[model samples]
Target: MPASRTERLLNLLIALLNTKYGLRRSELRETVYRDVSGNDSSFGRMFERDKADLRHFGFDVETVTDLGWSEDDPATTRYRIGKESNRLPEVELSPGEWTVILLASQLWERAALGTAAANALRKLQASSRLTDVELPVGVQPRIKPAGRAFDDLVAAMHAQHPVSFSYLAGSTGKDEQRTVEPWGLGSRFGQWYLAGYDRIRQAPRYFRLSRLTSAVTVLAKENYAPPKHFNIRAELDRLPELPLLTAHVDVRAGRLLGLRQRALAGTEGHTHTPDAGYDRLDVQYRDVEVLAEELASYGPDAMAVAPGELIAAVTRRLRAAADFCAAPVPAIAFHDQPRAGNVRKRTSEDQLKRMLQLVPFLVHNQGLHIQDVAERFGVSREELEEDLQILICSGLPEGYPDDLLDIQWEDDHVYITQDLDLKRPVRFTVEEACALLTGLETLNGLPELAEGGALESVTLKLMAAAGEEGLRAGSLAGPAVGPADRATLDLVRQAVSSRSQLHLVYLSPQGDRVSERDVDPLRLYSLDNTWYFEAYCHSAQGLRNFRLDRVQELQPNGNPATAALEPNEGFPAKLFTPNDDDTIVTVQLTRQGTGLADDYYAERTSELPDGGLLAEIRFGNTAWLPMFVAQHGGSVRILEPRELADQSRAWIEASLASYGG
Candidate 1:
């Protein structure tokens, strides 16, 4: 139902407070309730009712005392919402800002704020008189939350309480307990993180809420204080200042490592010892684990220089990963394995038939280089080149003669000539269909997959192919799992694909509400069984992550990318190379953190002094890693990069507020 006049008046009052700092009696009489009603005689009674309503709604409104011009001047008075209100300013948002808000709202819904944020957005739109604005064509906005657990975490945050949840450390099949005082919710690079005090290790931790299994608010409202001297912004700036770990390896034997370093160099930091050997060169990185992983492809030729702990950690993690790769799978007879006879093959021609299917992937990746195409199909350069040639030759019934299939090659680069019709019929073999179904099943479990109907439609197609006869023959005819809420998922997917911004009516962890944000969509990933969207947030003007389920309504608007993509002029080239000392660090991990060690180090392993693993890692930004370790409850520790260790300690201490202790 639409709000009553009184409710509208209340909203107007709040808006007035946000805009003018405070409202005077005369101003209130002249403009406050103009949109709702013009009854001046009842203004006094309305004011009393408004104050009562605001207080009832838990708003801390205050009246300041005028010291000098009092009794003689008819007692001038002004009213304003208190500091606790944390109300944002009231201003006209550009179309770009609206796009950001819409995107944020969609992500917020996935974090479990769908209903609340949606209602709030409606209210905001109504109040802003923006209900009739039409979005530009080709603009779509969508946001899908990570999951129910993430929602619970957001709720707990707003309640200002501790929360307990389970998280998978790495690819390992182990789960651990984590308790934290919710600090703030943020999105980075399309992933959402809950920054707070990790109670287990007594440090400030950033937990990827999407990775959490289950979350619930603790009854305790502990008074957790942030560090007096700690500043997140400062910490972010100093991230690239950490020292690098150096190593030497044979270039031929370590060709992969050399290539990775070459790619990473100039972006991070690296220096090559050219005379070390024809195929051997010395390399440096900020983190040993990262270096170990890069060099793992070279086998024994990659040797660590110092930081004995990193050497041990890299070795252990690589061995474990190798073991996983070598682990035997249960051997089943050909007859025992699921099968179908005389099925068709999934040719590239078949893929061209589904125009919608191709459009999303194509648009998602604006340009496709030869290397990118090769990686996507796991094919050789020659094979990808041939495919591109074939694509250039293929097309639909004419619209523009050059519309469907056109390619331009320049200096070894490839560009698409035109749009795809996406209406082609792609045939798949029975076995191929089954394999596709299985893949879809796995993707269904991901949080982001929920937003794109492509997955759902694929599943339905798989079911149809399975057929009633196949069902009678004991073949599964439906998806193993049910579909998620479609409307919500569709909203988020559209927003992301269309690059439209959003307005988020988000419910903070402290139960307070906010309804403004401008977010740039980057990538959507699944971690710990949930979905998260990492993006550049215009509100914070830095990279942030968002939980999709918390998002609400996703409106569309025209806006260019919030931040411009500049050439690598001032880009941290040193950070990308092994030469920069800031890129290397040693991390100590217990046996339990071996999975984390392996993931970062990929193929490197090292033994630690304390019978643990000291994994070396090379990283550009320390922002995400600290939060990752904190979520592990001290299982992983920053052995080197002293600044990071100190920051972690300060964060924990601040979260463990001395509640009269």
Candidate 2:
């Protein structure tokens, strides 16, 4: 059921729309009475309030006066809203705007709002002439969140009913049944969390989706009223933090000193065993998951020796990493991942995004250097010119000189002489606004876009343009972006476009040392949830992939950067190089390891009995291979490249020696 106010207002609309001539106050009382009070004065006040609301929503409540029926019947005695005015005006969406809406709608796939998003998309598409811009590739707007637990919680929220589920407590390492009135659901980092009123604690609690063990079931029949001023985001921000615990980790050699500096001081207790070529330090950590990520990233250089949960978490993280590495590559598709061979005809989406952005930008700024515009938009100068060429002949309907946009480009400078009524940026439809709002919230937690300060400004502008509908679009659950990560990415992007060199203090997990180097940056890409930048290092003098998380400090230099290497230039023909120095390690996979094949591309594979797999895998560094192989532990076994097996045993021996076991 809709809100009481909503239901009553809808009824009012229906009653007014149905009555052709007019309805007297007595007749309207019979038509709609669910929200009417028994007192005549109160009912009269309610009717007057309803009339005002209808007018606010653009409905014109007209009065039909009778000369004989005056004095006794007041001005509002016989009232009816005009049949035409009761219906909303048709909403018009530009092709680019429609494309954005379509992409935004896709972000909610398999999520709680999936149905509504789909419905909204279908309606927009039906009203639009947009068949040319539905291709995928460049227009991938997605935040992956799924499972029945998420679905059930969404249902409970919509129904305003209480929900019950079995939650595994990370601190106690135990499971408990919990009843909560779910206030909101969102994703932070790489996990989904539900904020709600907990019956057990009699306070709001946050539950991680991964910790949920049982099916979420609605426990209440009647709808419960939500707090009028309950703020989901504010409530989530108030969740109690876990108490700090000590993580005993063994650091080999002089490695991972950067980790000690980055995490709070004193957390790395000054305890050492110099003779053993390692140190046994007690690092204070509030969260095992975060600590585990740090330890796992160090590969064989660092080992969590104590606090079984921390050790287990490290092992889990490593296993997940190995699984990701072993997973097979997905085949490209037309409406999906773009592959050169499988590429489809270009769509209007990209052109539209560029045009929409450019028109507004040009309208605001009279003239700009062409190069600067290209850099700001993350496009090549040629691409910007091409877009301008298309825009010069583009206008309202046909390509008439006055109807078309008036733009001038001379000597690497461009100016918009006249907008031709395309002055301000296109206003977003309610669906488009909702889509943008949801996308903006989901982007809030991303480390790249989050800290750049650009998204926030864009969000403010979008909100102002979107009005109330955009404000009420609600929140989308997605991995929260970190500010630092976003800042780092933004800095790197600036360095990339300016052709400037960068001084980076990079920590190597395998080398176990913090090294400073100058690099010429290239493009940025994401693997899993982590961001990586492909750049040429002045020290290494080769192309290398740097994970954003491991970049401790970056100071950009003014040295002119080099041109990017062409595709298949100074690199292998395939996506990755298969050099003669590379190790070919073969393994027999247990059922769990078989999934790795699904995640990674295999050079060769053979079937086996008992649903197992025999596969050969390639590796650039066998030293790091041991940690990954050991991560899978018994589930994955090495059958070739005996050196890798030896290395795994060596790391294990070192770990045991550190603990004196």
Predicted candidate 1 versus true structure: per-residue lDDT over 278-338, tens digit per residue: 3444466654444544443233334433345545444443444333222332221122212
Candidate 1 lDDT at 322 equals 34
TM-score (all chains, Cα) for each model: 0.28, 0.48
What does candidate 2's lDDT look like per residue over 1-661, in tens digits?
A: 1234444554565456556787788766765654456877888888888888666444578888776666346554577767553332234555444544554555554344544455344333333333455422112335545345665776677557899888768868767999898776766545678878898999877888766655577866756665654545555566655677887676766677765655444434445443476666678877666676567656656778778888876665555444533454222112322112101123344344345557656665556788987864546788788778766755433224665578887877788875654343333434455455676666555443456565566556556645644644453345543334667877887876676788899987667678998988765544325666767888987777787889988978778787455322321112244455777777666543454443334456655544456666667767666666555443455656666655655654444343343
lDDT of 1 at 56: 34
Candidate 1 deviant stretches above 4 angstroms: 1-96, 103-123, 126-156, 163-240, 249-281, 288-307, 315-661
Roughly what TM-score does model 2 have, to 2 decimal places? 0.48
Give candidate 2 regions above 4 Å deviation.
Answer: 1-166, 177-182, 187-192, 197-204, 209-230, 240-246, 254-275, 293-435, 442-482, 485-491, 510-518, 523-532, 536-544, 552-559, 565-661
